[model samples]
Target: MSPELIKRLTEHQPSLIGLEQCRQAAVLIPLLETPDGVQIVLEQRSPKLKHQPRDICLPGGAIEAGETPRQAAVREACEELLLRPEQIQVFGLMDVLHTNTLMLYPYAAKLTDYDMTYSTAEVERVFCVPLSFFQTQKPEQYRITLPVHPPEDFPLSRIVGGKQYQWRERREDIVFYQYQDWTIWGITAKILQAFARITR
Candidate 1:
């Protein structure tokens, strides 16, 4: 990013900042490479989870008391996807973000293996999509619906050669690409958007 752009982004930091009433959640943005291009790890929540059941997400969870964000992210990734901390290379931290329901801190990581499995307890499925999809997209296509005021009917669109889709938020729906049977969405997509902008 240009210094000016970084400055502007930092000025907009309040929008990215999490709340002081935080629950200390952490997410790992796992990147991998294949002949197709660089890919990102994603997960589909179990249909049984009370919040956002069956929704697409990253391997993450609330940080236990005394646990650092890295510790929490590493532990959650291991427990959910059988991925060990030693197997992941930490990239860096992104700005904090919060929805009305939860405060989130996202960290980036690089994964070594393309082959992996998931535990059915919290994750229904695990998958990946090329990061190039975001390289060519814009954030305006994303929407923001307040938790207190959700849209009556959400709009859907096919993008990225039907490999990707989005559900309407405010003016835009969160961007998602289907990796195998898993659908990526929500804040996971937002974090991807931020990373794409920074890296591209």
Candidate 2:
């Protein structure tokens, strides 16, 4: 409308509109060089935890205030895996994933000098899966429909077809990978699938 407002708007950088309302988290897809081959480091959460207990996942957690996603990834790895910062070499950042309730940042890194140690309080145990397995194997995918339910107080009368108005439905695909006795699914499997595609 005004030249001043136009100039200010042009100078601003756009970001995700509602990201501030989402919980931010970061994860490190640690690559360990073993005699067999390059392996992926994964962890199983302690069953005693309140959320997602005993679920297999990457070494990461919520991003704290004033901490960058990269920093959060490294810190979570150090805390959960019982390693120092120097032991982990962060190579690159993967694509950012946006879910209904979370903004997830994944980083690809190499782990060195790790002796399979982990914090028992947060992690039940750690295991390695050959990266080649993901490179060669495909994950099983299933899609779920997401329908929006508008509030009853809304003015449906203003819309065409009134209460019968057809609202668009959204669908999301969930991936699953069965590796030995471990079952990797949900966000973790999705991330791994992306990583496999990128690396391949």
Candidate 3:
């Protein structure tokens, strides 16, 4: 095997940044074996939920205390999909992701069985798409630009034109993907995009 492949197989490390109130979370990229081929499992969050209601997502949530992201990923899959631990075989830990405040971990696991009963309170629906679909369909991209303007306070006392200093704007790229009737976008899309590249 190539050195890079070896590294990817061996490096399953976690990172914690030095920041307060920074939540750490994890998600499972549940791949199911089938007669046609391997497929990816995804979930739609319950509309009644407070966060990301009715959004299409992977089965995952916050990493509990004294638990590794790996542990959390499996626990979440079990909790959300009503699957036993033995039915899920975690294969690899992918790269970590960062949000405005949360640090997220993504794990790749294979589902040994197809039968599942998702938690109604947390999962609205469970769906699967062929891995080849993403291999063929590319996501649409958009960019958002935000220019920050500080308040016009009178505290610009002893600086070199502090109030008039030029500042740079921040830009973020948004991606969207359409599969028949579903629009997979945002963080979930990003995770799938990364997984697609890894597969390639």
Candidate 4:
């Protein structure tokens, strides 16, 4: 490889980091073009599964060892949505959301045609919420408190005071957009809300 090519490759490495060990993940925000204009595709996760079961989500999962976030997102879409690589065109990167244990990378893409067979084991149903709805209606937001609970072994000698030291936790908001019967919230809702704001 050329010297300049190697330099650019290293400079473009993913920025995800480990905080109590962050598990990298990626998802595709697919835009379906229809006669009605554009709609954002989403999946109702399989109720049979554990870990946030039955949540509304964009198509994605954990990033595999040999793939970049973009490749992972596209591969996940293919697995969950049964989309061939050629059927969709990736636009560009969206914002990356980092939680306590997960680093999620979401990519914006244009999806063609409604002919799709979703993996029933992974998805309960695939549906589209018209992009216009999100553009017009803002999501309901609620702030929840985060309380810090440190272990008894927490070093006190290093601090100016011992256990008397004051600690604070930041408040985080849980966003919701109720589309008919579906309650889209959490990370999925955050991604949708961000997309709506940017496209508006």
TM-score top scorer: 2
Better of 1 and 3 by TM-score: 3
lDDT (Cα atoms) of all candidates against the true structure: 0.75, 0.95, 0.86, 0.89
Candidate 3 C-alpha lDDT tens digits along 68-105: 99999999999999999999999888877776577878
- Per-model TM-score, in order, reads 0.69, 0.92, 0.83, 0.87
Off by over 4 Å in 3: 1-21, 149-160
Where model 2 places Cα greater than 4 Å from the true spot, the runs are 151-162
lDDT winner, 1 or 4: 4
- Compared with the true structure, what per-residue lDDT tens digits does model 1 show for residues 1-200? 89999988878746435455556699888888788888877888899889998888889999998999888888888888888677888887887776655778888888876476888989888777778877775544455464334244533232343323343443436666444465556677777888888778
Ranking by lDDT: 2, 4, 3, 1
* lDDT tens digits, residue span 66-162, model 4: 8999999999999899999997799998988887778889999998865756999899999989999888888999999888887889888799766
**Ranking of candidates on TM-score, top first:** 2, 4, 3, 1
Poorest 10 consecutive residues by lDDT, candidate 3: 12-21
For residue 24, what is the lDDT in candidate 1?
65
Which portions of model 1 miss their true places by more than 4 Å?
Answer: 1-20, 139-183
Count: clashes, candidate 2: 0
